[model samples]
Target: MAAYAVSIAKEDNMSTSDITKMLEAHADRLPTESGTTSFTLTDLGDNRYRITGSRATSKHFSRILGMNSPTLSSSAEIAKGGTPAPCVLATNTSPSNGRGIEMNNNARMTISGCSVQSNATGSSSVHLTQAFITVTDGSGPGKLCHGGGVYQANGNAVSATKELCATVTDPLAASLPTPTPTGTTYGNPGTDYSWYGSKTFQPGIYSSGFVANNGRTHYLEAGTYYITGGNFEAQSGAKIIANGPITIIVMNGGTIRITDYSASANSFQAPQTGPYAGILMWRVNNGSCPNPITFAGGAGFTYDGVLYFPGCLLDVSNNAHISTRSEFTYVLADRIMMVGGSRMTIDVDNPYGLAANLGGGGSGGSFALVK
Candidate 1:
């Protein structure tokens, strides 16, 4: 067997084609005899190489060559799927302590489905420098040191699965307190009531009120309505529909129930334009307890503006239907509790959909941290 050395240096300014030529030149130096020799190529300093190879030793020379002879076992067979003997082995051993492998500016790298275990440290188990790194399926058990599994430094970027194996420690903002409104009390009505612009109703509690008149409209200004102690219900036969946005404050220890009027009329709609055209809520303070803002009937309600509930109780019934059909978005209470027999639905087509939906609806619930 014979040896060959290949070198690639910074001074050479070698291109991909040049590297290919170097590799082929080294390959040409090997002996033509079938499996007579094996070669090992190690990178020396300055991108140079040291190649070494030898022929199988004869019985008499085995001892001098430190070669071991095996017994003649004719039945012995090579294991299937085993790594075949390599005619040559190439090792990248650039001297800057593995710094050569580090990417320079304007370089990028991506890795996927790789297990990074102990006794490993690098910018990343797979380092990508100055480039966009997209990691998918990076889940499962893996370990790393500094940036466990991956360390993205300045000019380096990384993205992994949501279920990354790294520990994240940060304080979450507390949920907004439930609102406490002041005024009169109103309950579910067998018939509906309509309201028009500039209609002044005394500040009080009202609930379980129905909208029996379809064309009838109601307008409420920026006033406080305490829904602390009453059942504010909207059922099938009595739809509590609104074309504009209304602000309601739920007091602590108060329970507000906005439910469906009927199975067929289970929806809420908001106007296509204008301010005060959406459904919104505000919490005055942290309630006596963390109560969710709940919607209990089998009907639906839609609002045009965003539904903002900093804190309150939200519950949806299983047999009920709740849909958002406006361009506005709806938000869930900071904390939500789910009871069986509740349904909540949101329209995907609407840009301003509900932040979260609980109960039997397809959209699940989520709690946003309050600052």
Candidate 2:
């Protein structure tokens, strides 16, 4: 029988239907099972092939081709001119061993639009070493996995242009979580400078000095503190330690002058706090206090913490000189509105090379400057 034929139609172009008919005819020429008809269509051209009906089993197809019976060389492969169209093997019934598809060492394969669900023990999906695999949307809804979605290892690198979505069945089981924003704030200056603690004033004109006696700590809190009219000198051994947290909120349009009075070693400590520690002036928070705060004077000031202000407006016409004794220095605020004609300088230096967490955590946060 001329099982395979090449016929020329009116049009010179050869159609795929013609090639399929030729291959089917060739397959039918082979011997059949005793009483069974000796007609079948198995191989497609271009190094690709297919199996259908009851003869689709590994044994039946392997015996006809004279090759080893494969556990799963299952799908149909279409011929595409030069190379073989990638094979797609699928199964209706679950495999006892949970093995889905296995490709030859040199087989270049790609799987798309499939799903693996309710599998036990073995991985839901597997890609071997040196295998290039890509998952893409097909005619259907796309791929899904229940047990272990897709497992690609053995030094394999996977990449996707789109986002990967997954749902976890259990909450306690190790899984990724959505992130939240928790910002840091300066301490309250009123409480920090009370008789309980010590407040360090920069080189500036203060009417009164910060009096500390008998190991007592006196510092200011976030609220306003009264000071007489005089040059509040930061003497040779003047240091400010915030007993709790301190935020210098200038209220009633009061002016505080911070100058660098140290002839040699002048240092200020600005420690990190939670949600409210820093410099705030000309700002009103009706929720807490409705008084407007104001800040003035720009002398050389050094703080070993973060400088932040959101609600208050600043006048930097007198550019303040700021420096840090330690290498770790971070300047962060809710909103920094630098007025025209003001100069501000910041210096961060730590001799031991220690980096402090300016935003509480070393990394992973947001910083914004609103007019």
Query: Which 10-residue window in model 2 sums to the lowest lDDT?
Result: 362-371
Q: What's the lDDT for all of these models? A: 0.34, 0.30
Candidate 2 deviant stretches above 4 angstroms: 1-265, 271-295, 324-335, 339-341, 347-354, 360-371
Best by lDDT: 1
TM-score (all chains, Cα) for each model = 0.34, 0.25
Worst 10 residues of 1 by lDDT: 82-91
lDDT (tens digit, per residue) of candidate 2 on 152-219: 44444333221222321211112212112122333333324444434443322222323323333334
Q: For residues 346-367, could you state the per-residue lDDT of candidate 1 as single tens digits?
A: 3323334432211111111221
| lDDT (C-alpha) at residue 356 in model 2 | 38
